[model samples]
Every structure is written in C-alpha cells, then in structure tokens.
Target: MTSRALVVLFKELREALRDKRALSLLALFVVMYPAIIGFTLNRIIDKAGSPEREGIQLTVVGSEYAPTLMAQLKQKNVIVTPHAPLDEQATTDLLRTAKTVAVLKIDAKFVENYAAMRPARVELWYDSAIDNGRKIDEVENVLREYTSRIAQARLLAHGVSPVTLVPVTVQKYDTGTSASRSAMIIGAMLGSFFIPAFIFCLSTAVDTTAGERERRSLEVLMAQPVSPAQLVFGKLGAATVLSAVGLTLELVIAHAILKWLPLEEIGLSWRLTTADLTFAILASLPLCLFAAAFEIALAMNAKSFKEAQSTLSFAILVPMLPLILIPMLDLQTATWMYAVPVLSNMTLLRELSKGADIGLLHYTLTAAGSLVVALLCYAFAAVRMKSEKYVLAV
Candidate 1:
C-alpha cells in the first residue's frame, strides 16, 4: 500500500515539475517576496540614518536682531540660512519646498522688548504636513535655553534670585528601547510571509484533482488497485511536499536578505540564527500540509480547473483571516494563539524575531495544531473520494 502511494506521489510530482507555468509561479514567489521586503527595509534604513550625516537646515528671517540666539542655534548643529524679512505667503512657499526644517522669525521689536525686559516673541514657521517633528523640537529646545539664560542674567543684574521665577520643575525619561519601538513594524511584516504557503500549492492541488477530473481521467485512476485512502494520500503528499519545499526556500532566502541588511540602524532586529530559522521552518511544515490538504479537498469538488482555481482562491482567505485580523486587533500573544494554525505560526515567528525565549511547548502546540487540522482535512477528502456520489460524478 505504501509503495502504491509512493508511486502516485512520484507521478504527480513529475507532472507538476514538467508543467513550466506551475514551476514559474513557484519560483517567482520564492524570489520576489524576499527581494521586495529587503529593498523596502533597506530604503527605510537609509532614510532614518541620513539626518545625522546631513545637519538640520534652519531659515532665520531676523538673524541680525538676535545674533546671540543665532549663534546658539549654529552651535547645536543647525545650518542657519539668514533671509530678509518675508511675508506669510513667501514663508509658506519656502516651507512647501521642504528644503529647511523650519523658519525662525524674530519679532521686529525684539531688541526694544529685550531692552525693556518685556517678553519677546518668535514665530516658528514649518509645514505641519511634513514629518520633521524631531527637528522642530530640537530648534525649540535651543530657543528655550537661550531665553532661560537671558532671564537668569537679568535677575542677577536686578539682585533678585532666578530661583524665585520657577515654582516647579519637570523632567522626562523614556524607557522604551529602539528594538521595542521597531517591533510593531516588523511584526506586521512577519505575518505576511506565511501567506505564500497557500499560494504556491494552488496550481499543483488544482491540477491534480480538478484538472484530472476535467480531462476524464479521474475514473481511470480510481479504478486502480490502490485504496481510496492511499490515492488521496499520494495526491496530498505531492502538493504538501512541494508547498513545504517552496516555503522553506522562501524562508531561507528571506532570512539571508534580512541578515545581510543592517536593520540595527533603524532600531529593528532580526535575531533569528540558523538554528532558530531551522526551528521556525520545522514548526511551519504542518501549516504547509494543512494548506495543501484543505485546497485539495476544495478543488476536488469543482467540475473544471478554472472553477477549482476560483473556489480555492477564495478558500485561501480562511487561513489568512487570522494572520490579518489578529495583528490589526493589536492583541498580545497568548497560549490560545498557539492553537490557531496560520496565526500561531505567525505569532511564533514574530516572537522569535523579537528575540523572545518562547519555550518548546508553544512550538509543539503550533506544529501539532496544524498537523491535527491537516489530518482531518485529509481524512474527509479520503472518505469523500470513496463515496458512491463522488464515483458517479467522476
């Protein structure tokens, strides 16, 4: 019986390999996804790192009025571009270009107000639409320091204590690290990697089941000496094996690309060592099996290849719903998450990427949960293939 099943498996795999269209689809996904992700992350790293090398550009309208303040701004790595007084429209046009972080306009009565010990005003002009909040905050900090110094000097000259001006003081400290900050972005991306398991096997599963029936050969194959269970196993095995191999290759290539890129620059980390990657691939194996088995069962019910393709395409979303919805809900990982097939695998990978030390029990549950589901799907398919109704339809 096992030998017969092996024969069926070999035949289906040989036919799949000969089909250039199927092979091309498999190759494209294995290469394309990793390349796209790697390129995107590399671009992000470049953009995040550029600001330090290129200092902030600040446009000051009344630099002559506040030479002391202007000197203070330059000392803090700001490249000050002194400009003559401009109207609101001109300032708007300048900010729209995004050439400068912000415009600092000192009031025309700055010297008069300073000499009179009145509070002087400064207008901070910037395009709120742009993502330059960090640069703007730095400019504000410099201005506050300059103002505080002048206030202290004036109080001393008046023989009054500067301490009397402040009733309270506040300080802030951030406890979040770069890795934790980046984990959210990277976690979302990790969930998408498992989607290809459903896609890579669609062609093979559809071809073997619905395509065989459409060509009027399913009945002839059913008449063979092997039992229905053996035949189903053979077909399911072929698709599952192909899906597993394709998914594993995609992971390896993606891991290599991720490792090569300097993610540390952006506070993101892909801490998956080779052993960790191997374990992740192993845990995901049952997911590939479940994908293939589920698709095969759905495809077998279709009358034609196109019908099977369409039906199974929609069916693929069943597994994908968890991957998408769970992340959107912003739910934390829990024991229950390890029991939900695709979602479990995604959660495991995400935790692993974050360098978490999730125990072996979670891994066992993830693999076992998918294995149990795959077995049920295969059992249902085997029983359906042997039914009188199925035989008559074939």
Candidate 2:
C-alpha cells in the first residue's frame, strides 16, 4: 500500500510540474506578494523618517500685527508665507491643494484687543481631510507657548505673580515601544500570508480530481490494484506537498525582505532571527496540508473543474473568517485561539513577531488542530471513493 501510494504521489507531482500554467501561478505568488509588501513598507519608512519641519509651509494673512508671534513661528523652523487676507472660500481652496499644511488667520482686531487688555482671537484654519495631524499639532503647540508667554508678561506688569494663574502641572509618559506598534501593523498583514496556502494548490487539487474525471480517466485509474485509501492519500499528499513548498518559499522571501529593510526608521522592528523563521515555517506546514486535503475532498465530488473551482473558492472563506474578524474584536490572545485553524497560525506568527515567549504547548495545539482536520477530510474522501455511487458517477 505504501509503495502504491508513493507511486501515485510521484505521478501526480510530475504531471503538476509539467503543467506550465500551474508552475507559473505558483512562481507569481512566491515573488509578487513579498516584493509588493517590501516596497510599500520601505516607502512608509522613508516618509516617516523625514524631518518634521522639512517641507512645512504655513500661510499667514496678517503677520504685522504680531511680530513676536511671527518670530516664534520662524524660530520653530516653520516657513511662514505672508499673503493678502483670504476669505473662507479661498482658505478652503488653498487647503484642498495640499500645498500648505495649514493657514493662520490673525484677527484684524488683534493689536487693538491686546492694547485694551481684552481676550484676542486667532483662527487656525486646517483641512481635516488631510493626514497632516502631526504637523498641525506642532503648529498648535507653538501658538500655545506664545500665548502663555504673553499672559505671563501681562501678569508681571500688573505686579502680580505669574504663578498665581497656574494650579497644577501634568507630565505624560508612554510605555508602548515602536516594536509593539510595528507588531500591530504586521499582525494585520500576517493573516493574509496563510491565504496563499489554499490558493497555490487550488489548480492542482481541482485538476487531479474533477479534471481527471471530466477527461474520463478516473475510472481507468480506479481499476488498478491500489485501494481507495491509497489513491486518496497519494493525491492529497501531492497537493499538500505543493502547498507546503509554495508557502515555505513565501515565508523565506518575506523574512529576507523584512530583515533587510530598515524597519527601525519608522518605529517598527522585525526581530525574527533565521532560526525563529525556520521554526515558524515548520509550524505552519500543517495548515497547508489541511487546506489541500479540504479542497481535494470537495473537488472530488464535483462533476467538472469549473464547478469545483467555484465551490472551493467560496469554501476557502470559512478558514479566513477568524483571520478577518478576530482582530476587529480586539480580543486578548487566549488558549482557545490556538485551537482554531488559520487563526491559530496567524496568532502564532503575531505572537512570535512581538517577541513573546509563548510556550511549546501553543505550537503543539496549532499543528495538532490542523492535522486532525486534514485526516478527517482525507478519510471522508477515501470513503466516498469506495462507494458504489461514486464509482458509477465516475
């Protein structure tokens, strides 16, 4: 039985390799996904590492009224462009161009208000649609400092202590590191990694089963001395092997790209070593197997390749649910997460990326859960192959 299963396995693998379309699809995913991911991350890092005030252009309407404020803005490296007073429409138009981060509209009564010892109004105009929140915050901070200094000076001139206006001072401390922030972003992307395990093997699984049947070759193969169990094992094993190889290559390429890029530039870190990556690849092997077996079992029942492809395409979403929904729930990692299939692999990779010291038990459960499902699927496929109805349909 073992020898016959090996024979079937070798035959399917050779045929799969010979098919140019299948090989092309596999190669496309192996190279394309990682390259695209690396390019995007590199661009983000470059944009994030640029100096804050490097290209900041701020438009001011009335700068003569507050020479001290203008000096403070220039000292903070802000490029203040003086312009004629603009109406609401003009300010909105300027912000829409995104040429300037924000506009400062000094109230026309600013000098009079200050001389009369009344509250002054300064209107800060910004486009909320733009993603320049950090730059806007910097401008606001400078304005607040200027206001506080003026208020303190007025208090001292009136023979009152400047400290009388202050009640308490608050300081802020952030405990989160760049690594954790990077891990969150990477975790969102990692769920997509396991999807290819199902996709890369889709053509192979459908072709070997439904394609063979549609070509009137399945009956001839079933007449051989091999049992249904051996045939099912051989076909499923071939698909599983192909999926594993494809996923392994993807992981290696992704690891190399991540390690080579300067993730620290954007407050991100990829601390995975070669050994850790190798282990992660190995741990994810069963997920590939489970995907292959599940698809093969479904495809064997279909009457045509297209029918199987359509059905399996939708069925693939079942495993993807946890990957998509779990992160949105914002649920803390628990043991139960390890019991789910694709979600388990995603969680494992996320934890590893965060450099958490998850124990061996989590790894065992992750691999075991997928193995159990794969075996059950294989058993069902074998039983169906042995049935008289399936033989007649073939």
Candidate 3:
C-alpha cells in the first residue's frame, strides 16, 4: 500500500514538473514575487536615505521680510538657500529637484499683519507624495515648531504665561513589545503573499483531481490494485508537499530581501526567530491540509476544471478577506483571535517574528481543529467518489 501511494505521489510530482503551465505558475510565485518585493524595498530605502544633511538645500522663495524665519531654520542645522521670489512655475520646478525639498512662500503682507497681532499664513510648496509621506511630514513638523516658538515669544513679550497655551499633555504607555508592533505590520504584508500562493494551490488541486476524473483517468486509477482512500491520500499528500515547498521558498525570499532593507531603522523589528520559524512551518500544516481537502472535495463536485477552479478560487479567497480588512480595523491580535485559521496563522506569524512566546495549547488546538476540518472534508470527498451519479456525470 505504501509503495503504491509512493508511486502515485511520484507520478503526480513528475507530471507537475513536466507540465509547462504548472512550472510557470510555480516560477511566478517563487521568483517574480521576490524580485518585485526586493526591488520595492530597495527603492524605498534609497529614497528615504537620499536627503542627507550635508549641502542639502531647501529653497526659500519669498520677499525679504522673513529674516527671522531664515535664522530659525539655520539654527536648526538645515541649510536654507535664498532664491529670488518665485511664481507658481518656479516653485514647482524647485520641488522637482533632489536638493530643494520645499519652498517657503511668505505671503506678500507678512510683516504688517504680524506687527498688528493678526493671523498670518505661510504657504509651504512641496510634494506631499515623496518617500512614503516622510518629506511632507518633516516639512510640516518644522513649520509647526517654528510657528509655535514665535507665538510663544510674542505672548511672553505681552506678559502672558505660555503655560496657559498648553492645557494638557497626554503621555502614552505601551504594554506591547516594541518588536511585536513592528512584526505585526510586516506579518500582515506576509499574510497577503500567502493568499495568492494558496489560491494557486487550491486551483491546482481541483484541476489535478476532479479534472482528471472528468477526463476519464480516475476510473483507470481505481481499476488498479490500490484502494480509493489510498489514491485520494496520495493526491492530497502530493499537493500538501508542493504547497509546503512553495511556502518555504516564499519565506526564504522574504528573509533575503529583508536583510538589506532597514526595517530596524523604521522601528520594525520583524525577524523570525528559530522557534517562530518552526511554529510557522508547523502551524501551516493544518492550513494547507484544510485548503487541499476543501479544494479536492469541491473538485469532486465539479463537472470540469473550469467549474472546479472557479469554486476553489472563491473559497481560497475567503481567507484573504480578513487579511485585507485587518489593516482597516486597527485591532491588535487578541488571545481569542488565535481560534480563527488564517488569522491565527497571521497573528502567530507576527508574534513569532517579533520573538513572542506563543502558548503550546493554543497552537495545538488550532492545528487539531484544522486537521479535523480537513478530515471531514476528506470524508465528504470519499462519499462523493462512492456516488455512481457523480462518477457517471463526470
């Protein structure tokens, strides 16, 4: 029986390797995805590190009334170069260059309004879309700080205590590990990568099984000396192994790409420790099994490859819905959340990556639950295989 199942596994693997379509899909998942992610991270780092302090210039384009503002900027260690009063076009041109990140456009009647104690507005012309919103934030912080300091000085001159300006200060206390916070965000992104990979596996599983049955090969296999259960297990086992390989490759790629990326600098400490990696690999077993079994069962119900693909695709995507919605909800992973399958793995991935110790009971329960579900699905698939109508319809 073992030899027969081994032979079946070998046959399926060989076929997958020989099939150009299957190989191409696997290559896309393994190679192209990593390349895109690596290049994107590299670009982000380069852009963020480009604006070094030495000789970095912010073009100040305005009339000659804001000498104090220039002095303030100079005192803050930023090199400010005074340019001739700029029109809209000139300001736009300055913003396009690497040297000039921004242009401080002073209103025409700035000094008179300040002397009269009236409201004054400063226009900062710059690109808000640069370097993942960092440049814009930097400019806004500088402007706000400068404005507040000036206002405080003015208030002091009028014998007013600046203490009244600040009504209250709120201090934040975080109970979470700094590493966990960073790992959680990166883990969310990693979860998205699995979605597409799982979709491929689900689609492929159904195509390999039910599609083969509809093509009349299943009867030929059943006519052999192997039991129906053995045949199904062989097919499911092959898919589970392949899915594991795909997942391993994705993790290796993620590790390599993240090596050069400055995740630590950005307060993201998303390194997968040894225990975390082991847990991730072990935890994924139930997920893959359940997904494989469900796809196989759906395929058993399907009359053709097209129908199976459509059915499995929709179901496989159900796991990804939470991944898409997780960012919007802004909720941290709670203990109860570990009961959910995909979300559980996602949360565990985050916790593990951040070096958090996960309880063995939780991991065991989740894995067992997933396995139970997969077994039930397998039973359903077996029942469908027994149905003469199903076999005859295909």
Worst 10 contiguous positions by lDDT, candidate 2? 47-56
Backbone atom clashes (below 3 Å) for every candidate: 0, 0, 0
Most TM-score-accurate candidate: 2
TM-score of every model versus the real structure: 0.89, 0.91, 0.83
Sort order, lDDT high to low? 1, 2, 3
lDDT of candidate 3 vs native? 0.72
lDDT per residue as tens, model 2, 142-190: 9999999989999999998899987787899978776677678888888
Tell me which residue pairs clash in candidate 2. none
lDDT of 2 at 393: 60
- The regions of model 1 sitting more than 4 angstroms off are 148-182, 391-394
Expressed as tens digits, the lDDT of each residue in 5-96 for candidate 1 is 99999999999999999899999989887888898999888777665667789999988999999889888888999999989999999999
* C-alpha lDDT (0 to 100) for residue 372 of candidate 2: 96
The candidate that wins on lDDT is 1
Off by over 4 Å in 3: 32-48, 53-57, 75-79, 87-100, 107-122, 126-133, 151-177, 325-332
- Give lDDT per model, in order: 0.87, 0.86, 0.72
Better of 1 and 2 by TM-score: 2
